[model samples]
Structure formats: structure tokens, C-alpha cells
Target: MTSYRWTMHRVYDATGNDTLGPAAISMWWLARAAAEETLQGSPLASAWLKLFRSHLSVDDPYWFRWAEDLAQSAELRRAYSGLYGRFVARALLSAHLGINRFVSLKRNGVVIPGSVAVTRISKGDIPDWIAWDDRASRHVLCEAKGSLTSRDFLAPGVPKCVKEGKAQFDRVETTGASGKLYPARWVAATRWVTDHRGGTPATLLWDPPQDHRPFSEDEAARHREAMTRAWLDSIAPGLGWRDADELLAPDRSRMAIVVNAEPGPVPPSQDWPELPDNDLPLIARLTEVARLDRFVAQRRPVPSDGPQDVADLAGAQSGSQTYQASWLPRPRGPEAKPHQGDYIAALATPFGLRPMRTRADFDLLRRAQDRARDLEEPAMIIGLPVGMDPGAAPAQTTWLDGAGISRKQDLAVFDLRRVKVDLLDSGPTG
Candidate 1:
């Protein structure tokens, strides 16, 4: 560490999110990777991304049943290693980078198609972000913490990630401006967690060992040098400190810094914000952080526009475009239109789902779930066929696949925007 100048910049997120700390920072990285799309004509722009999904997930019930029993008595480990990382990482990365993704680190750098973040530092490591820039042929290392020039610190639970900042200054050396002055350095623990927006950014001139008087520049230099060595030796001995600068520059691949990366899709939304999201990555990530009950309770995808279930078939359209499906038990007559109020409604767009004849629609004879969220106590008169046997065994469901014909679900839940209201079938199939 020679005579160096530290540069820090303050930027606001597009969503006005303040807590851009660890989990927020980390998850945003994942979200961007999840969102990026490969160009069609630009061969170089096409980078393959492989989405890795862990078997151990937050959505699984079996794990929590015996999570406490997961012994670490011997050469063993906690059951939630991957899960903790997933939750923290996902939470951190997206913590700050909301819909706009406004925090651009470098204006010009190589855009690695499937670039990877290397050596994930702990909650407070100086270099948490170490990723390669395939385009610039370099590796950018970033040590990010919120600005600490605050007159007051955070209240307990005011900013959740602030508790994790305790480790940032521990075992780290400090310096003062002169031998005559007391040594001082900005400590994350004492400062308020840098969330959303706050005081203007100010440069801190670190000082040496404590005293009442100020020291000369020469004294500050000596303190900085001695403390720098101690800082490196104690905190980041393995950081390859010597070649850090080289890796941070373009054409620095000559330095040995290798990160394993996998191939994945380049979504159209990556290029066009207005485009629809594939959300495969988000679905995979939430598997780690989602509550088990959420899956069972909703029993469906929450993001209305996300990937549709195979059983869902053709999902709802932006407009009220008519759709057709090879429905089960077949329609008895021609059109079965009930009162408008009889339909299971949605908040955004009214979901139109019905014509379910049996359990064969979703596998089981009795689970033909036609129950409404609120069935008006009795049931809305939805024009049931005459002589209908509610106790009759459900018909076997057969999934019919086609782009030529659109498919609609037999039922609709809360997400109206994503619902595929199965309406009247084509005529003359008696």
C-alpha cells in the first residue's frame, strides 16, 4: 500500500431503496445475471449462462423437520450452509438494485457474457466483489461500504444489515495524521448503515496512535506504512495484494486469477427493460428463501407474468383474447355462461376459470377443487348441468399441447394478470 488515494462515490438506486449493504449488493448481481439476454445477431454478445439450482431449498418441508437434528458434532457441517448463502446472497444483491438497476460501477468495462463473482468474501470483507470483465479482459475488485461520515449512528433494527458491519473494523489497523495526533479511522460499527440517501460523501484523513496533539506529514506517513502492512498481513494476506492492481486493469488476465463460470440464457429483457422477464433465475433463487407454506398455500406462481406451470398451459393474455383447450369430460351443451358475478375474480384482471368436470383435470377423483375463495356461503349459481353428480369420480385428465390452440386453466386463484380464463369451447363437439 503506497501513497494511494481512495475514491468513493455515492449513487441512489432507481427504486429509492436505501439499504444497499451486503445482501442487497450480492443479490443484485444475481438478479442482473438472471435478467441479461444474449443478442441474436451479435455472436460475441451471446454468452451462455447455466442456472444452478440446489436440491436443499427453503421451499422443502422435510429439511426443517430435522434441521435441529443436523448434528455438527464431528467432521460435519450445518444443514443450512447453501441455504444461508442463498438467502443472504439473494437478499444482499437485490437489496439495493431494484427495478432500475441504476448503480453502474464502471461506465466502460468488458461485459462478460457469463462472468462470475470470485472468492465470495464474508459479510464484511473488503473485497466482496471480485468478478472478471471478459470484455475489458480484466478483473474488477470492489470493496463497498456505506459512507461513514455521520454525526449519529443507526438505531437497532433501523437498518438490518448494520449488525453485520461489526466485523468490518475488527482486527484492522489504523493510522493518524501525525505522531503528535491520536490515530483515527472511520469505523462501520460507529457509523449509521449507508442506506438510501444521507450526508454528502467526505474523504477521511486517517490518523495514527491516540494523543491530543497533531502530527507532521512525515509522522502520518510512517504510521500509514506500518499499519498498511499489518492490515494486509492480518486481514487479506491471501488477497494476492501484489497483483491486485494488475488484475484491476484491462489486459490483466496475464495475472493468474481464474473463476469458474457456467453458461445461461440471455433474456430479451436484459436488452429491453420493457420486455417480459423469463424469471427462471428468480424462481430458482426463491426456492432457497421462500417459506414452505407459501408454496402450499398459494399452490401457484405468484409473479403473474413469470413462467407458467405445465398444467396452466396457455396463460392469460394482455387483452381479452378468446382461447380454446381440449377440455375434459367435454362440454355437455354449447355455451355455459354464468352471471358475471359467479366467476372467481382477481384484483388486477378478473380471472375466468371453470368448466372443470372432475379430479381428472388436476389428478385425483375428489380433489376437483371448484370451491371459491368466498362462495357467497352457498355457491354462486354458475349454471351447473342438470342431473349433475357432485360425488361422481373425476375423469382422467389428458394434457393437450399445441401452439395452434390456446389452453385455459379450470380454476383461477388470486393472480388475475396471469390467469388463463377458459371460456366457451368451439362448437359442434357433441
Candidate 2:
């Protein structure tokens, strides 16, 4: 079998150029090309790759060469022997770094141990890198980069560096001949690491933007150093010569994404007992999705998965305003005071409810009261205005008399200042 070795060369350089390190960019192309091969026949992956292309420097001719090389390699008849080890290493880095939280762990705390004899996804598993069993509780899946001086992992936001320094990568570098310094070329390039076992792909995103705020250049360098070593250490445990059967050639047609990579739209109506109370918000969301789906269906297929894509479509639809104004009746009601003007206007508007003033004004409050009483629960009203003479004096309670519905005496009133009342039937107009 012929061997293909890809060495990182300085393709582009400028003291001020912060685009990507040459090694990083080249590695990115290789990893991306390999990642794309996983779904060669998939139209979905093709479309996604098209979207992915926009993120790259479109004018770069090397990218085209990289793509061509990947396509041609897919047709190779012999086993990819020499490049096998690099590919597996690439996959492990991709699996861990791609997650929101990125970290790697050691097995039995080894220092520069020889590559294990294992090859293939089964031995490596998916999301190839994971922390030691004890470390899982200490950190999240997200990865953060920072430098450590002595015992302290240094960064600005933190008051003090991690004192315990139990992180695994620390020991390996100190004992190994390579030491802690990450190969300059390895740290410079971006790679699309894949978890063949788990089938998830994430960019081994460790590079800072060259101008990271909050972090000094020295700090950023240290952070990158730590992350690079962590990634290298992750694949070290299972490293071995690649087996022809283990490597998967990129498939242009078949789309490959992480398991449950996309989420479905939430259902509108939930199952309820006997009579169901409508969930207006859920219904509104469902209705919007339906409307947008109908529109997109006519133009192109709406992916059953890809929740974010669906949301983007819905957001675009919602951003546009649709006015539906109707004729309003002439003002023939009683004149409103200065304060009442705002209240009156709000009532006239759509989706507006008038404020309850007098106890009798709580007529429509029956539903709320019924709900509260049925559950034998008390309710409190919030943000009510303070009115005049609220603590003046108590008024005699009165109501409709026998023959006709007429007030007999001042309605029962108490000082609202002293006690914090849980329930208020109604209150006077401010």
C-alpha cells in the first residue's frame, strides 16, 4: 500500500494576520475533507457542507485541492496503512473538543505510554475523549483554555488558580521526553475530529482569535498549550497503527450527523384529563411552524430534524409585521378623567383587559375565584395603585336591601396600611 503523509507547511503568513495558523488551517482542510467523506452519498450533508463552505475563505485555491484529494482518496483500492494512525488521532480530538465542554483524561495515570494495540471505533468508542471517572464530577463537558505556572492553572477571571492540580495531562508532560511543549505545527492547524463509534463530529476548536480580550497574549498562549496537550493525551491511550478495515472513507452522498443531532418541534396540545384547557402559547408556536412548513414545502423540503433551522425560518416569518385594523365605535360613553384616559385607551386596544375597581367590578373575576376556591387556595394581587384616604377610617358595610337592590350604608372598608391582605375582592378607583 502506498503511504500518504501530509505535512503542515507555512501556506500563508503575516505578523498581523490572525486568520488561522498555517498548520491549523491545513489540518482543518484535511479533517473537514475526511469528515465530509463520511456522508458521500447524502444530499443533506452536501447541503450542510455548502453552508459550511461559506465560513471558509472562499478564494483559497488550496481548499479546492484539499477537497479534490479527499474525493480521489475515497476510490483508493488498497489499505490506507501509513495515514491510518493520524486519522484515528484526528477523530479523537474532534470528538472531545467539539463538545461544549472539552477535556481529556488518563487511564491508570500513565506517562507517555506506548500506543495500545486497539484500532477501529469499538476500541476507541465515540466522542473519543472523556475524563477520568473521578474528574467527571469536577468539570462539565465544555472546554476552557488557560495556562498554569506552578500548581496554579492561571487566568484573569479567577481569583486563584486550581490549587489541587489533579488534571491528568500535567503528569504526562513532566515525565515524557517530549515534555509539555505541544508541537508548534500541531497546535497551529484546525482539524475536524470524528467519533467513528459515536458518529459525532466537532471542530477541534482550540485556537484563540489572536486578539482575545480579557486575556493577555501570554495567557492565551498558555491556554492553547494546555488544551493542545489535553487533546494529544486523549488519543495517546488507544494509539496504534491504523487498520484498513477500521478507516471509513468519506461518502459524498450519505448524510452523517450525531445521534439525535436535531430536535423535533414540540407538539402543540398536551394530553389533559376530560376537559382540556387550551395552551395558547403552544398552539401559537405550532400554528407558526405549520404556516412556515407549508410555505417552505412549496419551495423546498423542511428537514424533519434540524430544530435550529426550523426556528430560523419561524423567526424570519415573525419579524415581519402584519396589521389588521378595524373600525372603532364613536365615543358616547361617560367622560374619562386624566388618569382614566390611559386605562380607557388600554381597554380599547386588542388583547387588553380593564382593571377591576369596585368589588362589583370583579364580576368577570369569577373564573379566577372559582379556580382558587376549587383548590382551596388563596391568591394575591400585585402592582395595584395606592388610592386616596385608604387609611382614613372604616366605612359601614352595606348592600342591596329586601325590595330593591340599593346601598344601605357605606360599604365595609378597613385600613389597608396595617395588615398585608392575601386576597382582595376589589378596590376603589384611584
Candidate 3:
């Protein structure tokens, strides 16, 4: 399976030491994080999504092959290295440290009040990304660097990158809504190599002890509103909306989302569970293969088992059932029958967003849409195969075990140790 091995470190004065855990992360989650970071509300979101869908692989060494091919062109190689570096940094910070939302330094500097004056440093010295940590109630800054060079060269070069990133952070400043400076942490993430088995990403985090007030309730509200807008904008295309404005239109009758469930026997409704109402709008579980036909046509490298292997990996086994469920909006005043168009039947699968062609498939979705219109309060329909109990756990499979990781929906993470950490200054082991 394709994955990135990562390690975290803390730098004190002139010395650096490894922090607790090192691990491997699935490319699926990394690609998802990259999409959130760069494609939200972007004019080119569709194109970027297509690119990611084509390149991402979970059960093959496709990334290494892609990187090797790109290395033939110096310009493309440089661009890929920089972009991949930021993606890795975002993935690690989000999955490991719980910092999810991110805005480029350029965007944040302009949008946040009073940031322009505080971040007037030279363009080259600005940090790469800015994020808020609701758990810690503090802002986080990150500067990411990447290289595709040999290990001999990277041994010396990685520390220099970290040093320079720290210098950039030293020049940056930010403030919360009350006009007082907000507490912040700094991180410098470096992926020293790409296209090689030995390459592993590393981070240099400098979180000094400091006392500062958290964002006020009003400040948090505004921040949440902005982040929510960005999230909606990012997934608008995937949800078949023209844009965020159209998706958020007050008069719009239906809200649509595409959920990409993991490959395994379908679990009962109780095991799967319904998402909370507040999270419904943000509940898109995108899969790596948005369309299998297109994926095969591109002739991307895969395991020797060929297209069937790809199908299994993408959760599209033959004879597998597609299930649709609808959650109807609450009614008001005297109850009147909802219009036929008012109902929306969305499925939980990784397949392409297309109409079901089979007679049974068509009838199931059509009946679901009709039933939703008859409800008074919000209601959900859970679809299960004929033989399964409504409360049974999903059947286990050897696929995940073969990959050497625990499954969390489509996400898989594995711990690692003894990975090398080359720092300029020697420090006592932590």
C-alpha cells in the first residue's frame, strides 16, 4: 500500500530530539487533507479533484512511479515536491495534532483584521499556512519545505530548512478580535525526499510555554462561520452544486452529499449510525477513486490482479448492493404533501455520481424519494441487504490485514519506530 512514514521532533535552543511517536499514514487521508487545504472554493476545484483522483493510490506504489516520471522534468519535479510537502504537513498536523482548518499565509494576512500590519515581512519570509486549534484555543503557524534529493545531500539540507523556517516564524505576528496578540505555536515540516523507499517526512515543532487569552465567544463564532463557508465552498462541486452561493441559497429545496463508505460487508443501520443534524451539511466522505472507468482508462499502475483488484480496492465488487437513504426536512404549519422534487436520495458509496440503471436499483431509490415526502419530522431510511440483521457488525475481511493497518472507514494508520532523525545539534534523547 502507498503510505508516507512520518516523525515529529521538538527543537530547544540549538538541539533537537524526537518526540513520542512515528507512524505511517495512508495516502487516502493525505489526499483528502490536500483537497481541503487547496481546493475549497477554488475556481479550479473540479480540475484539481480530477487530478487527485487520478494520482492517488492505496494498494500500489503509484506515487513512487508518478514521482519518478515527473523527475524527468525539472520544472514539474520542483512543483510536485513543494506541493507534496505542504500536503504531507497538512495531513500530519490535522490527523496527529488536531489542527484541521488551514489558510495560506497570504490569504489569512489579508482576511484577518490587523494582520496586514503585523505580517508585513518580506514575501519570502512569510509562513506557508495558518490554522486555529479549537481544542487548545490558539493559532498555529506552519512553514513547509520539501526536496527530492539524495539522502547524502538531505542529511545536511533538512536542518537548514528548519532553521530558515523558524526564522520566518520569528518575523510573523497575529492578533485575535480583542486587538490583543493571540497565543501561537510554530511548526516547520520538511519532507526530505520523494520517489524513494527511504523517504520519510519529519516535523520541527516549537511550542514554548506562554500565557495568552483564547478567542472570545464572538471571535470563535466568526471564525467558525468563515471556516464553514470555506468548507462548503470546497465540496460544492463534489455535491453537484455550482458554487457556494448556490448551495447556500435559502430557497434551494434539497441539500445533496456523496458519502464514500469503506470496502467491507455492509453493516447494520445501528452499527453505521446516522450523522448528527448539525453535521449533515458537512458530511461528504469522498473516496480516492471517484470513477473507476476513468481510473482504468488512464492506465495508472496497480497490482498484478488488474482492474478487479482496483474494483475491490474501490469498494465496487460485482453483485454488491448500492444503498440510498433520505433525511427529509421538518414540516411547518398545516401539513401538506411535499412535492415530488422535494425529496433527495443520496447513497453511501465510493462509486461515481450517476443514476442507477438496473430496475431494482431505480425502484429502490424512487420509493425512498417518495417515502421521504410523507414524513412530518426529519426521518432517515437505512438500506441493508436481505439476509443481514439490522443490528449486526460488518463482516471482517483479510484485505485490511493484508495491508498491515487498522481500518477507520477509508483511513489506515500504522505506528513506526527507529526511523532516523538527523539534526544539526546533538540533544539528549527524549
Candidate 4:
């Protein structure tokens, strides 16, 4: 756009070499340095960067600095004018700023936390590069792709978000040069490429009209202007300082339902003197009485043959009072077993669980669960419910509640054929 005393031809004419056109090579090297410099934090540092003498090797002398002038010469500019501007923008952006982030643009206090590139430009993919950044909040999703111009933005699989975009490059770190990093922003693409990552149809860049008609040029300018506005709005929220946690509050609230799976403990009878209006208690009492009556009738003691025999029979069931209720009938069918529900097992820690049972006891029991061999340890009592069918074997259960106080749920029948093990005696109670 501006005249310069040192032109492309002057640089290329100084050397007689050809191939790897000087302009193309210059732009390539400039782009690489620009990208690295931007990453290091200063976009303008490239202005002072000098090419190494070795760069004049057979790789093509016409490619660097000199070739750049040829590509932009009045003779060539009319034929490839669009490419000239795009190439300049790409070099400037790469030199001073990174992709996917607007820091290249010199906006203050903006950072894309997890951005990473997954593709490159040379694969005929058009987007010189692509990057991804996740949404900090459910309401906001941000990602960006950049190219030399709108035409270079499209790739067969590229998505719509980056089809054609503009970028303001900023300083970033790099491993090259003297390792001196500073803040420098650079001007880059005005067109975007796509939104999607992975798979085909990822992005499409707008193409400049081949005819270069006046109307097409005007339309292209208008579209480019609209895209800039959209880019500003898309990245505006990220630039402002706001609490991401506040935006995430609703997600936290919805999780409370997971804890409500179990009803809380029945409060102390004294604290709740008046019973709940529900008739559940009445039904429970009647059920218990009927069960006790049936058990007594079915388990009539045989007439004793003598005092010695009676004493031996009594010994058949040996245990302290704490384990009296551990022997209960198990359920019928193949499914008969003790199931430790999540809430039921978790209750032992808060309430004083049982006599001689300290917090240490619960910890030991939990560890034992992991090792199959440790399951039969003496501290836990194993028994089956009284009514459990003989065909349906009862489960070996460990009592967590304080020493078998005959709670209603505790006596629920597992099956009829269980060998009751008394917790106190550490022996069978039949």
C-alpha cells in the first residue's frame, strides 16, 4: 500500500539465483518467525530480526525478501494482488501472535486456557492453522481458525465458524532467537475458517472472485467488515473480567438430588414425642406380632427326655444376648442373599454403631470388604433370617448397628435354613 526505497526487485536482482521464488521464500520465513515471536510476547520484534547468511543456500535465493518484492511488483500485483495482501497478513500475524487467541490483536487480559492446534494448512486444508478452546460456561463456546484471506479459509471438511476470519496477533513465547520475550501485536487475516474439529467438512473460507469484478470486490469488503463485527462480539465476554464460578452455579444445584436417595434416620422418639400422622407404624407393629406368633407355633420345643439331654439341646444355640436376633429366616429362590445398600452401610459412621465398636472397627470392616479372604473375620457376625427357605441359602452378614437390638428391619427373614452364628459366642446358634 505504501512505496518503499528498498524494493523486492532490488533484493532479488542482487543475486542471480532462481527457483523457490524470492518472494515466496521471504514470506514463509517471515511467517515462521512471526508465529514464534508472537508466542514469545512481542509481535514487533520481527522488525529487527536478520536472516542468517546460510539462508542464501541452494534452497532457493529468490524465495525470501527478494521474492516478496516480485510478488508485489506492479507487473505481478494486478494478477496476484489478493495473494500479496494475504501473504503479508499471514507473516505479520505469525511473527507477533498465536492463532485461536485475540491476544495477537493486543486486547488486554484475555487468555484461551486449553487451546491446541490439530491441523496445518499445506494439506490442501486451506486453513493455515486451527485451534480449540473450551467453553468456560455452558452459555459460551469459543474457537477460532485463521488463514491468509477468505479464499484460503475453506477446507473440504472445515466447519463454518472459521470459514473466513480476521486476527489481531500478540506476543507469545518461542524457543528461537535470543530468548528475549516481549509484548508485540501484529495485523493478520481478516477472514475466518471454521468451527468444527475432526472429521470432514470442518471449515470453508470465502474465495475471492476470479474475474475481480467491481461488484464482487465490494461484496467481499462488506462481508469482511461484518465478520470483524461478529468476531468482536464472540470474544467480548472473554475479555471482560467476570466470575466463571457464578456462571456455573446452576450445574452445582442440580446435583443435590443424588444425596436424597435415602430417607434420613428416624429421629429419637423423645424429640418426636408425637408420632407421624402416617399409619406405617401401626402396620409395622401388627406385622411384627403376627410374625412372632407364627414363629412360636412352628418352632415348638420337643418334650425333654431328661435333664442332661435338655442341657445339651440348649447348648445347640449358644451366644450372648447381643446376637440373639442375628439368626433369622432367609428369603426363598436363587436370589436369597444379604445386600449391603449404599445408604445402609454408610450409616454406621455417624451414630455410635455398637458396643466395643469404635471408629477403628468400621475402618477395619471396610478394608476387609476389598479382600475376599478377609470376609470371615471374627468381629462380624454371620447368620441367615429365620423364615428364609431352606432352598434359598442366606447371606453371611456383618451387623453395623449397635449389637443386635432387634430392630424391625434386622429380623427380616432371609430364609428358613440358616446356621445362625452368634456374635458374642463366635459360634453357631441353631
Residue-wise C-alpha lDDT for candidate 1, range 297-377, written one tens digit per residue = 123454454432221111211110111111111111211222111121111101212222322322220122233223311
Clashes within 3 Å, all models in order: 37, 25, 0, 79
Predicted candidate 3 versus true structure: per-residue lDDT over 14-110, tens digit per residue: 1121121123343434544544443333323223333443443322231122323234588866776667667666765654455544656553253
Name the best candidate (by TM-score).
3
Per-model TM values vs. the true structure:
0.21, 0.17, 0.49, 0.15
Candidate 1 lDDT for residue 356: 29
Q: In angstroms, give how far residue 371 of model 1 lies from its true place.
A: 49
Model 3 CA lDDT for position 327 = 11
Candidate 2: tens digits of C-alpha lDDT, residues 153-183:
1111111211111121222322112223221
Q: Which stretches of candidate 2 lie over 4 Å from their true place?
A: 1-101, 105-213, 241-310, 313-430
Model 3 local distance difference test score = 0.37
Best by lDDT: 3
Worst 10 residues of 1 by lDDT: 1-10
